[model samples]
Target: MIEEARIKKNLKQFTFPRLSGTDYEIKAYKKLTKEVENLNLKYKVQFFTFSSFYSRIYPKIGFSSVSIILFLFYLNIHMSISIILILILFTILIISIILTRKPEKIQFITKMDSQNVLVKIKSLSKEKKNYDRIALFISHLDSKGQRFTIKIRIRIFKLWITSSISLTATIISKNSILRGFELIFYIIGLFPLIFNLLSTIMMLLNTTDNSSDGAVDNASGIACNLELLNHYSIPENRLIIIYGFFLLELKNAEQWVLDIFIII
Candidate 1:
């Protein structure tokens, strides 16, 4: 049977601060390690770092730039090509500055009280014999700021719609003059894509919440894994559960894991 008390204990331990690279997250990891030890399960803490670019400011700037470009394109003004080149260059420079600016690091941060935190969990059954591994459980315990306004969202949607239409025109048009217009539309379409890319980047650097309160985002999953651990008692098979709290955006890693799962 699943140990409800143990699960609750894990949940309680996770309730504290869990910001990545912070004392809280480190504390949580230590607590997790303790729990694994109490259960006689082998465990390890894996430390990894990723560039904190996306979760900061790229999305807002990219979205704003795309919106402006789309607006200008819609107006049908025949500006000199030189002006367009200058504007694009200026926009790139602005985005580069916004994205590369680093936040001030906290120097006097308190160290996590590692005595109560759990760092890893492993199954005792696997230590004695070889077994086939099934499903991996994963979760992230981080929150981020989403300051995008409704107006910006609407603008992005419209830019996407317009870009799609422009792409279609570029693909189907054959006449030289129409082809030129299609090229212009195709170029406009790029703005939204670029904006989306930058928005994705912005999400990576903005970790603003406890990595452990990730209960809804992950504690539930941990509960499920614990249940799995209890029910699947086959000594010849194994399962690996990972409670991951990251400081960066998770889309790429999540997708890669999903793809691997599908293949396996």
Candidate 2:
């Protein structure tokens, strides 16, 4: 039976932010593990430690740097060779940043350990071959915070999108006059760049100051994953079901889920 009341009760146990690689994150992981045990299921906790830079810090630095680069690109149309050299460096910096942002890429200097709880359900049929296929379900347990309110976030996204277009226009535009005109979008983008600066600062802040309890951000997702598992049973010799609760979903630092899938 999938008891909504029980799920709600469990969620209440951890109402604070679960920052990636933080103590609170481990507590939540333990709590969830306890629940899995209560259900009389077999599970394993894969403890793996990985160290990386504060995820938000570098990305924010990257964003602010790119924003400056865009502004510089617009302003340096007729600048000297020295200015051009600086622009080249900034461009290379941006490229390097983009490479490091993905989940699979490990470019940070600091490493931290994260846990993934794996629950496996096997088919009960006499023949193991009867259940040939495997189904996997995943959910992340962590939350994040940002500087701008929801309202401002929309405007920020719009600004970012417009900035991309503006940058593209300037890059491809052959005429100086037209390129100058396209620079307006980039100018408008400056407003969000200011917001980006605020975001960068917020990113560097600890989860206590910058992260939220994240009820809607990801609590609901975890709850749903729990509920779905509770509501169903694995058939014997017909299916194998695996449930993985991955830690550290904040700031794009988690790729442990992918690694888990490969292991499965």
Output the number of the lDDT-best candidate. 2
**Index of the highest-TM-score prediction:** 2
TM per candidate comes to 0.50, 0.70
Q: Which ten residues in a row have the lowest lDDT in candidate 1?
A: 111-120
Q: Give the TM-score of candidate 2.
A: 0.70
> lDDT tens string, model 2, 1-264?
678896786667656788767787887888888777776777877776644433555555565566656555544556686487567768767666676655445645766667778787775665755455556677777666665566765665565556556554654452354554655655654564455445444434422333678787677767766765665443423245677777653333244334333222
Across residues 1-264, which tens digit of lDDT does each residue of candidate 1 receive? 667886776565566555555666666556555544555555444344433344334454554454455445443367786468549956785755654453222112232211111123344553533123424445554422234544764565565555545534443442244665755655654664455444433433333444335665555544554444444433334343333333343432443344222111
Runs in model 1 lying further than 4 Å from the true structure: 74-78, 81-133, 145-212, 226-264
Candidate 2 — which residues are off by over 4 angstroms?
Answer: 50-54, 77-110, 126-130, 167-210, 231-238, 249-264
lDDT of 1 at 70: 43
